[model samples]
Target: MENFDYNLVKVFCSLFDTENLTETARILNISQPAVSQSLKKLRNIYDDDLFVRTSGNMKPTIFSRKIIDNLKKSIELIELSLNQKGYNDNLFYKKNYNIVMSDLAQSFFIPPLCLLLDEANLNIDINILQVNQLEMEVKMREGKIDFAIGNFPALKDNINLISENLFQDCFVLMIRDGHPLIKSDGDFNNYNLLSLIGVDNNITGHSEVVNKILNKLGCKNKMNIPYYSAAPDIVEKTDYGVIMPSFIAKKYNFHNTFKIFPILIKENLIEVDVIYHKLFKNEKSTLTLRDMLVNNFRNR
Candidate 1:
């Protein structure tokens, strides 16, 4: 293998993403020979044929796959250091930017955000997605999403991710109408509680923080309800209580149909944040939207 070619890393990443050399060349707007030459240089530097052509796609070798993440980080660091290109307001006019956010954030935060845009008379195309935690970071960096908003453990020291906490939120125990616990807040201990993985709108895994708080709140009877869909069904059929963010409980007016009780857990306040990567971090629309959220929640 020859010494590494700094510029070829971009070519290699493009090939990896496109899979086909022809398509990679087309996307890069380089001649086929130039792409082949770049691939050759990359292969020599890595001491392995990084790509094995099969079915018109380049399958990465094990060694190449192992270094892919680090290579990406380095490239991203370089991109961050060289910020000659930043997000422009004019781009919003021609292209629709994809905004990836959790269902919970969309429920509580998007209303005021959309209103803020309308009020300012900024014409921009936006699409929202509700995605789980698995491989969500990969999707964000791969350009699948221009920005992401929710609980972001996705930030890394070298990766081009930037995050900000919008505000804190808490949970309220809710149950359907005619629930035995509806009569009084103290009656909450009588019904079974179903809760999401975490109280902070996390869809990834169990939260020890939530468990500790619930333990303090006298929730001795609890079930690990993994999905959000379970909340409506369980609350409707029986006297079971579902735990969710206070914002959602209030938004749905759960107090009318169900019993809504504050957990009063002994701990720090739970918070919900809006996060985005550094590539799109400087985008005025993104920052403006973030500020609007902070303001709206403050007023709320």
Candidate 2:
């Protein structure tokens, strides 16, 4: 085992079939010299002339044929174990996956994502939890959380976590269709009169930026909700309006139930990302879920 790296085994298997160093290198994505070095190591380990150089090709010797079957089986097992996390018929059982999601993700991302997961025919449990930016690192380190989605300010430069930006979202003022502000010809001069509703539980940084803009505009009345999904109902009955992500506003504001208006003030675009710890950097399940999120929400 000391002399046997998986790389050496891979080179051996490729060379066994190709019999040409150039062809083996091409198949393995390595240089010809590297393949020659691996063959030299294999020769030293086996103490046999594994291949005999012929006129146009290298032919495997009788010793090579004797051990090739076992070597092939070993390589197959190694590769299967390496890719064990990939979804398959047996692994997709009643397993629970806990994810930390934001209000925006809950309203705009969860429904479509759940449907996609269900389509995979996996009886898996999904637990979507909420965690603040300051607490995300701790929870991920403890392995109490699987992954998180949203604009996490604390993880922007954190080296311990790996993140992929899915999309950019901007804040929009969502109001009921027949609100007085809509009747006022889009005039926000009286915006201070309406109570401002904001979802701030997920710590996506949108609320902070929007809060500052609301303050600058002298809109004193404010209400903070734990979930963004509740804002649509709250605004439907009352004169309250919420500043939410553009994607959420568009997805939930169906049936002309709400009107979407850009935050007249220049608001910073929030970068939505799927974040996980470095420990799961190469884990196939994490990578699979990340790819799904990118496909579902990435800017088209």
Candidate 3:
């Protein structure tokens, strides 16, 4: 361990995160050969093949997995010690942040976030990716995703991830403005009278909860679709009502094309959260962005 080069730690972590030699080089701003040489040196120093190629990914060995958490902590400690004077909030270099969310969340968060970044003159680019709930933890840990913003009940159980509740949103039904099924007084006393266009539960995360509410109300789902953005148009041109987040229903109701009605049930509310990898909790750039999101959107 005395002969180990501390500089190789950065290479090792990057390789572990990306699981590809080429990607490690790209992330570290170095040549491929340099990254390869660093990996070789790390293997030699540890007397182990820390990573093995499997199914196109550099899967870490048992030794690597055991030591990774400590290595990450050491890196954070070193950075903190070096930056005793404090980190500069002004970002001078271009950085790209990948975020995962549903279309419903995109409509609510992207516009304001983009404006804030532009107004601050920050050299940051945001890539809004689609939901891959199963791989979300691994992606965030590997730095492939910076944050996931939306209601994801499945993510709450991961100890390696941190979740910050931004706000509580309830499910609402949207129907055409002059739907015949609706009462003249605008009361939705019975959901069984109207057939619903359901959002695919697998993608939206909140659909299962909404489904439970619908079951209690004895409502019937006529059809299922994967895209939330398509619901407004579908409901506007047809009698089929769609269930969605209240914020999203309101957003699409700007033109008075649809009438929004609360699900009128206790279990209709869902929590929207900002989730990130715990490993990056103390990282300067991560902290800045997380704080920005919480401050601007929490309880709003």
Candidate 4:
């Protein structure tokens, strides 16, 4: 049995593949002096030069030949054992994860998210924080949360984060029930579109999308309000209208109130996506949560 410096194990592997120190250094991106130092350390550990220089190819010494296969096999077995244990670890079953999203995501995606988690029987503490899209990624990296689900307009091209579309929802014109303007035939022409502002300033994306859709539909006139309330709130106060996600409209019965009022546009839908860092891809609990959220929207 040869005593070995595990630090030299990778260097030996590189040498074995290349069979030349210059090539090994180039491949390993190390100086020749560093490679020589590693080789000397390994030789001392083995009590033998390990490789004999001859005809520009380093031939294995008798001592090296005797133990190389055993060394390789041992390393292989250790790696396999580590991987198998990793797959079966209890980490996934015993984690508390926090997630961030808009208020709307809670209303739409949470029920299904909970159902999936319940099935997993995981004792996870989930914190769903209300954050605007701009604050989401930083919150994830800062450990303020583990995941985020919603619109991500600020994602850069360099971002290597992972995201999946949970579901697509179209923008809809929302109004109260029995609004006189909607009573007339094609009365959509007379109604004002509402936008929630101030605390509800996040509606700008929906507002712009609605405008583009309405422009295509030839409905040039639209109004907006910026009060902070659910898309359902547009119905409680005045006849003022709002452009909102079609799913929220449908979920909250806004559709029945004023009708979909055809946007007269070609494109009517936008997707809501769930996002997380790639580093969490291997975290079983996070993956479990991700699958649950996806299935929740998928099955719906």
Give per-residue CA lDDT, model 3, range 146-202, as digits (tens).
999998888978988999999998988889999998888987666787878888845
Q: In terms of TM-score, which candidate is strongest?
A: 3
Model 2's TM-score against the true structure: 0.67
Candidate 2 lDDT, tens digit per residue, 1-300?
488787888777767766778867854668999998999999999998898899978789999999988987886676567657555444222366778877667766778887888876566678988777888887776557778888887787888788888877787788888788665665455576778886665467666777777776777537787777788899989999987778778888668788888776665477888888765443345556767777877883
The number of the candidate with the highest lDDT is 3
Best-to-worst TM-score order: 3, 2, 4, 1
- Give the residue spans of candidate 3 off by over 4 A: 1-94
lDDT for residue 22 in candidate 1, whole number 0-100: 77
| CA lDDT of every candidate | 0.61, 0.75, 0.82, 0.61
- In model 4, where do residues sit more than 4 Å from their true spots? 1-89, 156-158, 191-199, 202-231, 254-258, 266-268
| 90-146 per-residue lDDT for model 4 (tens digits) | 545535677766666677777867776576566678887766556666666444667
- Report the CA-based lDDT of candidate 1 relative to the real structure: 0.61
In candidate 1, position 284 carries an lDDT of 40
Selected candidate, larger TM-score, 1 vs 3: 3
Candidate 4 C-alpha error for residue 92, in Å: 1.2
Clashing pairs for predicted structure model 2, backbone only: none
For all predictions, the C-alpha RMSD in Å is 9.0, 12.3, 5.5, 11.0
* TM-scores, each model vs. reference: 0.56, 0.67, 0.72, 0.60
Task: Give the per-residue Cα lDDT of candidate 1 at 254.
Answer: 50
Task: Name the weakest run of 10 consecutive residues (lDDT summed) in model 3.
Answer: 85-94
Question: Given candidate 4, what's the lDDT at residue 28?
Answer: 52
In candidate 4 the C-alpha lDDT for residue 173 amounts to: 69
